[model samples]
Target: MKQGTGGKIINVASMLSFQGGIRVPSYTASKSGVMGITRLMANEWAKHGINANAIAPGYMATNNTAPIRADEARNRSIQERIPADRWGTPEDLAGPVVFLASQASNYVNGHTLAVDGGWLAR
Candidate 1:
């Protein structure tokens, strides 16, 4: 991007970026840092027409979350907490990712968009 004049930088953050998780102090802190650095990059790179943003996905039924999904009790607890009442799927992120990558989000920068199925709202 720097080699040219403009570009989009989409980073992947996590729900832990916005809140603390059990036994995950380091993970939470690091994801928070991802958000911070994304903002800083936006601040520093905007002049060059670079848009830096992040996506904070909630509980998803992916390889990374296999253990959680396997534990029926924990899975139920999480699903109940989310207004959507289910774990997010990788497919759920398609639209947001597309928007951020497209000119539709030209004015959006340095923001962490949550694809959490209303997890944060609850």
Candidate 2:
């Protein structure tokens, strides 16, 4: 992308970047790398009109997290930890993604927007 027309690069990151799961070492490491790359690319491309950012989503009730949600106790515990007191929905992240992709956020760069129902705040 750097060599092509200058453009925005949005990275899909996860809340795991801020917190670690008990048994998911690789997932955690990968997300941390996403954040690192977002920052690095943003710094390198600022002068060329290319923006880089990341979106870190919380436990959305998606196919990937269905197993966790299916466990009643686990689901309840997860909800309690989030300030919003509920699981996130894919729709909840749409606005952030749109904002980053549009000219409305031209000044924004190297930011990791968390659509996690305030999970990281807890």
Candidate 3:
């Protein structure tokens, strides 16, 4: 994007970026770094017409979490915490991604939008 002098950069972060989630300290740290770097990029690159942002997705029913979903206890614990009362689907991210990339969110830069089902509110 810097070389091109203008572009949209969308990064994938996680709810862990804001919280010290259980059992995966490294994951939490990595996501936090993603959040920081996204903002740094936005600050430096917005002048070049580059919009750098991140999406912090909550628990989703993707294969990446297949094992956790397979485990009854872990699955129940996560669903209960989410006000949505169910796991999020990949489709849930469609709108947010579109907005970030489209002119609709042109003014939105360096923002890490949490697509959690009110998980952070709890």
Work out the TM-score per prediction.
0.95, 0.93, 0.92
| lDDT tens readout by residue for model 2, 51-103 | 99999999998998999999999999999999999998999989999999998
Runs in model 2 deviating more than 4 A are 1-5
Query: How much lDDT does each candidate structure score?
Result: 0.93, 0.91, 0.94
Leading candidate by lDDT: 3
> Which sections of candidate 1 miss by over 4 Å?
none
Candidate 3 local lDDT, 19-112, one digit each (tens): 9878898899999999999999999999889999999999999999999999999999999999999898999999999999998888999999
Cα displacement (angstroms), candidate 1, residue 88, comes to 0.7
User: Between 1 and 2, whose TM-score is larger?
Assistant: 1
Q: In model 3, where do residues sit more than 4 Å from their true spots? A: 1-5
lDDT pick, better of 1 and 3: 3
Better of 1 and 3 by TM-score: 1
Itemize residue pairs with steric clashes in candidate 2. Answer: none
Clashing pairs in 1: none
Candidates ranked, most accurate by TM-score first: 1, 2, 3
List the candidate numbers ranked by lDDT, top first.
3, 1, 2
Tens digits of per-residue lDDT for model 1, 26-58? 999999999999999999998889999999999
In model 2, the worst 10-residue window by lDDT is: 1-10
Could you tell me the lDDT of residue 9 within candidate 1?
A: 94
Q: Return the clash pairs for model 3, or none.
A: none
